[model samples]
Target: MQRIAVLTSGGDSPGMNAAIRAVVRKAIYHGLEVIGIKRGYSGFIEADMWPMDLSSVGDIIHRGGTILRTARSEEFKTSEGRKKAYLNVQRFGIQGLVVVGGDGSFRGAEIFNSEYNLPVIGVPGTIDNDITGTEYTIGFETATNTVLDAINKIRDTATSHERTFILEVMGRESGCIALMAGLAGGAESILIPELRYSIDEVCEKLIRGYKRGKLHSIIIVAEGAGRGLDIGKQISEKTGLETKVTILGHLQRGGSPTAFDRNLASRMGSKAVEALMEGYRKHMVGIVADKIVISPLDAAFKGKRTIDLEIYNLANILSI
Candidate 1:
């Protein structure tokens, strides 16, 4: 490929900077010009782009979020908006494009390619880890680590006061974050949307733990399960325990990426560049079984990525 452009779209994810760096450097190494599209398809349509060099990404690997920035474009969902973006692509002579984000971003890439016959590649960069065909997305490790850190600090207070704490973590649909963080943080009860949850049963567990000489209790509630305020009220009313709720909202979305995330982003980013150079398009790079694989771009959204119920069950058994 003579030239390619990259953009980060949808929600900003940690480790996105690392991925951007890899894409820029990898493209430059292959003697291809790299362009950064600011604000995703919004910028793509507006022609807000500039050429990038190796030094453009030199110091971004350790940073969180995206250097190119990100924004959800309602206009881009329309055909007219995409046509404008296609015109800009031709205007700049960009032969290929790389998109980093969730399935929504991939869907956009798929549509753009279908309309204009442009080459596009997708790199999964969501913290939700809900994209199909990939075991883990770019920002999941950092987000899970962020949640674990919050719960660790909450545990200290829960123990000091011998009170029950209900921690609500971000996971609007997928419970991967809740399940992973709850299991690792030694939570007493974890309520996720995927599995059936019983508030009465949750309270019973707390009461039973109390009877068994466990004074401190931590119940992790995924946002998808119920609002933390409501769940805390239900549990407190049932067990008569002084319960408090702590919602780790946007905090989970920001942080310096962990080593796993950095490495994964680096690998995915480099692969995206290589894929374009190797005549691949309308596909996404996925890491399955520790090996990088390519799949149709729409594969990320064709089905839902489910959590391992066995892990949830094991977490319950160990917590009890």
Candidate 2:
């Protein structure tokens, strides 16, 4: 029987558990012994592992975060650490490994596969949605939904107080989450890392809204777009308008997987299994145009995928 190991790394996001559950079930159904690695690259070096079965993954599809948990370990970067990890894999008799994480995880997978000849499969699990090979990652949809919920609530408070609230969502380098959530939440202005805006322009917009007798305004800013608090201060100083700022932190990564995420995870997980069975190794399972596909792990690690400019422009047009 084939032995496989799986782990999640980097920042946690919604639907990670669902992906893990799918990996376990799909691998086991294919007559492979599945092992769950605790923590992340650290667990691999420390040899922290546990047996995973259907029962162990029961009811996790609806959960958030990860059942096996996650962390960042610099050990994976060191040659010694890589060697130790290779020894551990052999010790456990693991043949194929699955990693669910963002770009950092993909980098580690590429190095591990290149140096040790270990076949590693990557599943995009970051809220940033910055991984190039995948059109949409597992946690991105749920994170968008979570931000929308918060944006709605903030809108209510802003309207009541007649205040202009600047809401900040997390998406370190990639603006995918901010773009989608801002568009869906009907934000008046969206600031994304991919697009830079003039502070004077934003103030002018606020001034225009005030002239139009708009009581409240919602401006969504990506964390990496700039600085939410700084922007709010600037707006308050420029427009002499009362402003409130809300930063949605890990809250975006802690909700139950949405219907879309559950379905996507199941499909991606199953496809990953099929790819392995077909003798395709060292790849990432990604969804492009609603179809399951595999891309080279190295390619995913090399390219920088940011928010699509056309989509961002369309969002601006539609918002107008």
Candidate 3:
């Protein structure tokens, strides 16, 4: 295709602007037009499109969030809504689409492709990193670093007060964020949705630590695992340990993109434009084992990948 349109959907991640820059600059380098679709699907429904030249994306590589902005629209999920989106595409002469967002965003892209025969490529850009098929999503590294920053601060306070802290990280369904952050942050207990914990067992461990005069225990919990507040209340009622809770909500999604994410976004964005030029469509560009690969959009939607049990097991060993 000679020209393609790109949009950011759902909640914005840190490196989305970098991805947009890559797509526009790379498409231009390849002699193709790249249009930035504003406010995600709404942009198409409302026909809010603009040409994204080199100047449009200047100095955005280090920026957080998205340049084109984002939104969630249920109309895009409907047949009539999709028809409207495609009509707008035809009005603008757009031949393909590059979507940067999470799983829901991908599903919308898939629908657009099926109904309109428009080539669509997905670039994973969510902080959740819960999307299947891709080993690493664009915002994950930055979010991890953000989580660690908070974890370290919490750790200092935890140590000072000799209290148990339950720190919750965001991940809607998958445990990748919690597992990696917990391990990296030296958390004493890591609770993820993938694992079921016995409250008695947890209390016993904390009681043992208390008997040994251990100061401050750090507990990392995935938001999907269980409510951190509920668990904290349980521990307080049962073990009578002074507990603190820190829920790192959208704060983790607002920082500047890290060097790693920026580089990855650049590579993935260029690769996406290349794939479209080569007639590869309706696929996701993902990094697995440091290699860029294309996965069918359908396969990605049908599958839900989970955390490696072996890594979850290691948390137990380290917590001891």
Q: Identify the candidate with maximal TM-score.
A: 1
TM-score of each: 0.98, 0.97, 0.98
Error of 1 at 36 (Å): 0.1
List, residue by residue over 142-260, the lDDT tens digit for candidate 3. 99889988889998889899999998889887777888888888888888888788878888898888798889898888899899999999988999999988898899888899998
Best by lDDT: 1
Report backbone clashes per prediction.
0, 0, 0
Candidate 2 on 1-320: residue-level lDDT in tens? 38889999999878888888888899888888898999999999999999899999998889888989899998889999999999999999988888999889989988899998888888888888888888888889999999999999998999899999998889888788888988888888899888778889878887887788888889999898888899999999999999999998889988898998888888887777677777777999999999988999876768888667787787777655
> How does residue 275 of candidate 3 score in lDDT?
83
Lowest lDDT 10-mer window, candidate 2? 311-320
Per-residue error for 277 in candidate 2, Å, reads 2.0
Scored by CA lDDT, what does every candidate get?
0.92, 0.87, 0.88
- Candidate 1 per-residue C-alpha lDDT over 1-320 given as tens digits, one digit per residue, 9 for 90 to 100: 79999999998889999999999999888899999999999999999999999889988888998889899999999999998998999899999999999999999999999988889999999998999988999999999999999888988998899999999988778898999999999999999998898898899999999998987999888899889999999888888999999999988889899999999999999999999988997999989999988898999999888889899999999998
Candidate order, lDDT descending = 1, 3, 2
Clashing pairs in 2: none
Q: What's the alpha carbon RMSD for model 3?
A: 1.0
lDDT of candidate 1 vs native? 0.92
* Backbone collision tally, model 2: 0
